[model samples]
Target: MDRAVQRTDHDAIASKLSAVKRGYYEDEYLELFCPRFEPRLPLINIGTWCRVRAIDQAITEFLEKNTEGKTQVISLGAGSDTRPFHLLPKHPNLVYYEIDFPTQVRKKAAIVRRHLSQKVELCDSATPVTLEGDINTSRYHLLGQDLRQLSLPDLDESVPTLIISECCLCYLAPESSHLVLEYFASRVAHLSIVLYEPIGLDDEFGRVMAENLMMRGLCLPTFQKFSTLDSQTSRLRELGLTHTISAKDMEQYYNDLPSAEQKRIHRLEFLDEVEEMNLLLRHYCVVFAGK
Candidate 1:
């Protein structure tokens, strides 16, 4: 299958799973919206949510520190996400630009419209009930452009900008990934990126996740591994992102869990027994920074 031609059904399912849970995206319509996208494994849902929570926290911190009051945000591959509604309440001065395929953008807009209408009934925040509605008017400017033939649009130099691509780099060919990061680093003054990837304990687990994705009729150009963190850091340095945070820093969040939960986490059967590295850390996420 062509890498860019993502099966809509599969993509929708992934989006649902990705968004739902506090500290996560909390989108409750996944099962109702796309039932055919079944997660064969049970823990997949919670595991994915935990990973997303980590990503959200990482990006939230970066943006809070790096973004100026008038900064703009570019969210690449933004799925059925509620970030505009969630993040904008606190940072009203910041402008957000969301980019995704036409279908996702349209569906998300409709949902935002419906939700905004019901916000008064559902939410307690004094933040205007129609804020989502107002933001929906300009929060997401749909861009149907593909990444391979991508270029930055013209914007003011004084406006500090941040580019985000959550769980997108894995789908990119290695060369394209490098070029895209370089492109973002060159265009933005202070930049930080959070890339949530499916990793393996070693090459073996990496291959397993790749195969699992392939079985779903998807292609993974690269499945990053925890062991390669050093190489990734070095590569980002060359790309002009001077700061980096490896998955190791976030390990504390998971490691500090209740003893029983940690035990359950360790027993996750997703790994290849032969892999020498710790399976949990082997396949996870990392944050990159460029100043």
Candidate 2:
């Protein structure tokens, strides 16, 4: 909740504007979770927002191009993300699945029941069970599974599948990350994988960033392993995916975006720290691969 507020208030990320209202108890918890800094660092928030926008755009384009068939979207480590509700109205054929830790899935199911009961259906719950751990609805499904031991339910190979892993893969060891990627790649015949994760940890800023995350007891084991566009694309190809594409950082992505949209977001915030923002963006990337 606090992180969502940071994106909306400080970085001017408009997609997160509805986060507080849709997220139960998020408004009250924001006071405790909000950062103390007066002028928050916009780099992280910008990177996050850019990543979301990029992924959203990719999904939109995919849906646009493949309009005839039913599409399935699986969000790995999808924690309290309201994208399923947001997307269901426009794309009725889209089936959304969110996978996360058991506790996180339970909390999200409870919140959705309380706030969005009319729009969503809870699985096996008489009155939308909140305390329960797993969720299975017509349009949305939530599973409790550790990424290291990820075992997805049987899905149709004929239907095009989109697997999203936003800031989730970096937490796993390199071997584990490959295992998850290969698992999905081998099963899903028509599959597209979109990944957002931090890279470029060999430099000074990257080294410092790694140290900070380590201090917080969070390690990015794959950052240094697949740190560049070439490495990222190569890794996917090695895992049996084809037609891979990657953005080195948000700067490249922003440049590829519509000029009007770029102008609009640039006007939202006064950014004086260009060098720092560039360095920060350069350390993160978005990689897309399909088969």
Q: Encode model 2's per-residue lDDT on 1-291: one tens digit a residue.
A: 222311222222222332333221122322222233233345544555677777887778667766897999988877656667677667878888888777666666666665665653333344344446676666667787777788766666678888898777777789998998888888888888888778888889989998987765667778879887678778887877777745457678866878886676676566678788778878778888777
Residue-level lDDT for 20 in candidate 1 = 43
Q: Model 2: residues >4 Å from true position, as ranges? A: 1-39, 120-131
lDDT (tens digit, per residue) of candidate 1 on 167-210:
66666677877777777777766666666555442667667766
* Candidate with maximal lDDT: 2
Q: What is the C-alpha RMSD of each candidate to the true structure, in Å?
A: 6.2, 5.7
What is residue 193's positional error in candidate 1, in angstroms?
A: 1.6
Model 2: residue 141 alpha-carbon error in angstroms: 0.6
Task: Give the alpha-carbon lDDT of every model.
Answer: 0.55, 0.68
lDDT of 1 at 185: 75
lDDT of 2 at 36: 37
Models 1 onward score TM values of 0.70, 0.83
TM-score of 2: 0.83
| Residue 202 miss distance in model 2 (angstroms) | 0.7
